[model samples]
Target chain A: MPNASEPPTTSPGIVRRFWWRSGQRTRLAVACAGVLGALAVTGAAGFSGDARLAERGGPGVAVHRGDSFEVTVRAVSGVDLFEGVEPGTGRVFGARVAGVSAAPCWQSQSLAVAENLLRGKKVRLIVKKDGDTGTDRLLVDVELPDGTDYARTVVDEGTASADVAARGELGPVESAARLQRRGLWAGGCTGYRDDALAPPSSTPQTSSTTAVPTTTTTTPPPVPTTTTEEPAPEPPPTATEEPGDDEWLARFEGKRCLLEGTRRTSPKGTEIVCTRGPRGQLRWQRAD
Target chain B: MRTEDHVDLFAEAVEADPAPTRVDGGRPRGLTAEGWVRTTGWLQVGDHPVSSVLLAAVAGLLWALVGAAALVTEFPVAAGVLTLTTPVVSGVLWWLFTTRLRPASTARNVDTCRADELEPGDTIRLHGSIGPIGQVVEVALDDDARVVLHGGARRTWARDDVVHLAELLR
Candidate 1:
């Protein structure tokens, strides 16, 4: 009874003091977090700023000595990464790729632009330092609108993945046989390293005879055109029209080189366009 | 998943893309455009991984325990050393946290080939209306039956001639 009478009105003070002690640890932790956070902010700002500065290529696009590369700097939908040459040349740069001038990546230095391009997008920049081959290497860097950038080392030949990336087999067997007779690419794609190619081709499947669509023969009837509308003043070319591989081959034969070099696509697949370069100078562009 | 370490590494196979570009239709390209490859392989550092990160954390924990034991009592002189080490350990832990938090599973465009589709291996022709978006590739083998190729289907098909489908279906 006597002990119960007074467990100390001060017991509340002990509890409060305990809480204060606990609170001190939490406050210390919060303070540490705040300091660390500020340090992190400063560190990140300094680091990212340095990276950006490095990216700008203040030294101004220093290439090797004489490296020539094929490139396609154009307007990609409303997001071009090039500016027209104010040095008084019509040659468009990456800033114009998206068809606008303010693509954040459009650095005036040729080297800096080379350092920033999308994977498949093309731009011709030469790495000419002093002694490297004039056409030393092809390089491109791309920065997506969302602050992500990608780079690709352009190869001398489109052979990094496959010696022959061209699609479609001999249009018809007889045509394939003719190609065999010509021994295209050491008898055509059959020459790609058997081991390098997945599921190695063992017997070299040769299709000297034509095989029609065995999957399903639902060839739609040819739709004839009436040419009802008036043609535009200067119609764009019809490079993308679908045709048989043999037909394409025929056209390709007439045009040994694609005239225009390669095809490119924006990340969103919003659009794709064709481009070409001769000895690394961007020469043509098509949207078909 | 370590069991898959030595397996065919399609785990890192990026979305499929066709090399020789073609136009499908008014907006059509060949089925090859929507082509893809299956693979399995090691992911790059800063990429996306679960087991590797966990293993790192575990290893760090062991080192931290050793560090703590060294700084207690007899080595109170090294307590400052331990304090300095804490943040270095903390930085690594933070990076691991960030890696887990911000992984590189970014969405990318890709396409693939299938068996018994319009571009069947035996056949070289694929006649179908690829859905407006390159997402729903409806290769119509028959009017009532349109085989749908989904996922990565972004390519320009310029030629719709009869061609081999087997090449892309690997």
Candidate 2:
């Protein structure tokens, strides 16, 4: 097929020529080995974006638009899902199970319960928009596969207590767990209801019991005792009554005080003084 | 064809007539990214001969598939496998292009002769392996080997390894 007048067709040399004649499978295998090795080297060297993203372990903020999404639990810290002890960074958004607070006295044990129950399990996340600030911790009802509320389960398991501050009907479940002497409740751990009764201690007081209600003198009376039966009552109307002149010109009560420590005599001859009330609001109080 | 004709045919297939002062493949050249890509990309390293530009577009597509799989969590297990494998496969394809496949395609483009036929003062590729067009130095015969200047040092290559010799043209 070659013209004698034209120069010879150059051979690619023995090895290359032999390679050229090699079977398709051998060439393909060699190609695969080289490529896979290069990728593994690149990943090991930290050059790939995928490797970087995986190392970071997902995003700090959950990128979702709707009221709910789904996620597999990566970790559990205290009562929050995917939240490390430190704030933000290398986390998949801070989420706390709605309606339950981890029992302060048994926080480590509660974390263990949560980790055992939720780790690597897929759960439906129902975001509570009203409970969230849109930036920080998101209030979510973590629902397991069978539509069971994870927070309620924790409360039932006695690892966590029902929180009046969060929305849920978990008070009765917590009460039942305590009455049955389950989990932390077996040792009479302080529940959220008990914490409200004796508010001074930052750590849950293990010795706190029904006897706390009898020590009303040492206990602040402002705490709503009916919190278990009803929603907490509105903060009692502050007793710092304004001078009444605005309501009825006949009396100088329920009116703002002119100056703190100032004293005035009412039309009925009752003495009133401007002083700071229990709520720190400077107002008129009967000096009698 | 007769036996003599077969012999002539085989000889012609292997060796080119020595021309005095071959116009090309006799001088040193500069390396560039574009030149490297041309020699390494496309189906240059494979049995398939395709334009490097076309192959680059295909590689870009593969990268997109891989990137999408990595970024989107909703993607299924198949997508995960695709993300894990595409890069290595692409790398292998590239390696094949640069080292083995591309050379097979473009080898005949340069002036070549059996290493035993090389004369003194005849410039040839410093190393016999197909790679970035390397240094071109004048070679001299030393017994059964070809001697060439490499990195300011004279090194001799066995004629068997340097079975065929060519000079860097570009």
For each candidate, what's the DockQ?
A: 0.00, 0.04
Relative to the true structure, how large is the alpha-carbon lDDT of every model? 0.29, 0.47
TM-score of 2: 0.39
Candidate 2 Cα outliers beyond 4 Å, as residue runs? A1-34, A43-61, A65-67, A70-95, A105-123, A128-139, A144-288, B1-112, B119-123, B129-170
lDDT of 1 at A187: 25
Cα deviation in Å at residue B166, candidate 1?
83
Best by TM-score: 2
lDDT of 2 by residue, B1-170 (tens): 33854455334353222222223633222222222111221122333333433443444345546455444443456556666666566555654554454432122224556666665445443333232222224466656564443233344655654432433322
Per lDDT, the best of the predicted structures is: 2
* lDDT assessment of candidate 2: 0.47
TM-score of chain A of each: 0.22, 0.43
lDDT (Cα, 0-100) at B115 in candidate 1: 26
- Candidate by candidate, in order, the iRMS in Å equals 30.9, 12.4
